[model samples]
Target chain A: MSQALLFYFFAAVAVLSALGVVFHPRPARALLCLVVTMFALAVHFTLLGAYFVAMAHLIVYAGAVLVLFLFVIMLQGAGAREIALHQRFNIIYLLPAGLVSILLAGGLIALIRGSAFQALKSVDGTAENIGTLLFSQYLLPFEWTSLLILLGVFAAIALAKKDAA
Target chain B: MIPATHYLILSVTLFSIGILGVLIRRNILLILLSIELMLNAANLNLIAGSAMHGRLDGQLSAFFVMVVAAAEVTIGLAIAVLLFRQKNSVDTHEIKELKG
Candidate 1:
């Protein structure tokens, strides 16, 4: 019972804050809302019993990713006026986008409702189990991810580098 | 324990909201944030499936998704910064060179 309550509470937080991220005018504020949504999702991961995943979610997303977002938003001064102006002209796209999203959600939910999910015992998401799987079954992909991150770092630097005038 | 279906529904809702944000938002930064939302929603689905099936594979997949998301965001924000530097604004409508 308590688990359900907690799940509902965090789910509400996640949804509301996600909406904030979308609709908030100021980029900084929207980034803050996204952080909130990330934290809420982290909690959901915990509730689902993926302990290592929950921690990774918190550290990777709420910690590293959101801080990066904050730095970018701060570097660029908030542009409320520009956003307001854009919002005025972009109202035409709003209704159609909202309708499309609603239809997609509805269709997915109906499909999920029709499927019969087996009630298997929940898996243990301990670090030990994940580590074993990572080093054994997933070693190749794990090594590849390091390469991906290294490439990402180089790309970011190359793209964001200042030109010598 | 909450049913996995409920979690799936939540993920779907979150994903849809992300789609809405990506479609309607004019700010490039906000579009990136929306993309993060969608990725997180997918992560939730994977974890839920993992819990439902009592397997570690789904969790591993979610972990990979996080890695890819981090890489994508790094490149994406760098591009956003580049766009801001060249254009002086992050508004999508301001960039029309690609319209042709």
Candidate 2:
């Protein structure tokens, strides 16, 4: 019963905030809603027994990413977006795009249908287990992903510089 | 009593909404926010599958995914700023100068 309730709560938060993020007209409100969604997803990660992932989500996304977004929106000023949105709202490009999205979703569900289910055991999805696996089985990819993140940071900085002039 | 398919379906539905946001919304900020939604949906599926499969690989990939999402948004926002500087508006509709 507890598990079911937890699932319902997280799912509701995730789904609702997700919609709010997309549907909110104001840029700041939309960014804030997405932040709430990311935070709730962190809780869902905790419920799934991945404590490290939960904490990482909170720290990286809620702490860093959303803060960056909020700062950017505030710095750019909300009045500009409001003025533009008031002038024109064209959604004619969305119909075909939405259909393509629906088709992609159907494809994902069909792919999952073909996969075999393996029952879980021991439920040891903790930080210790993650650390163990990281050092033993996934050491190479661990370093590689770190390199990828560094490259991403550099690329972002470079992009900003290239257009600054 | 939870089925794995439930998580998958929820992720798919959220992904679809994100796509709609990207495709439908005219604001660049909204488009970027939609991208975040899509990435979160992917992360949820990853963690859920990690729990079900008795492995940490999915969770690790999810960590990387979050990192990349943050990085992508930063660069995207920066570009949006540059565009705003040039064009004075963030509307995807009216900012189409290179449409070919």
Who wins the TM-score comparison?
Answer: 1
Give per-residue CA lDDT, model 2, range A5-113, as digits (tens).
8877888888898888777767788888888888778877887777888998898888988888888778778722543444333568578767877798779768778
Q: Which stretches of candidate 2 lie over 4 Å from their true place?
A: A79-89, A108-122, A163-165
Residue A78, model 2: lDDT of: 73
Q: For each candidate, report its DockQ versus the true two-chain complex.
A: 0.73, 0.60
Off by over 4 Å in 1: A79-82, A85-89
TM-score of each: 0.93, 0.88
lDDT of 1 by residue, A1-165 (tens): 897889999999999999998888778888889989988998988877788998998999989998998888777787443357545236667788778777877887787778888663568889999999999999999999999999999998887666632
Compared with the true structure, the alpha-carbon lDDT of candidate 1 equals 0.87
Tell me the TM-score of candidate 1's A chain.
0.87
Tally clashes: model 2: 0
Model 2: DockQ vs. true structure: 0.60
- Which residue pairs in candidate 2 have backbone atoms (N, alpha carbon, C) closer than 3 angstroms, thus clashing? none
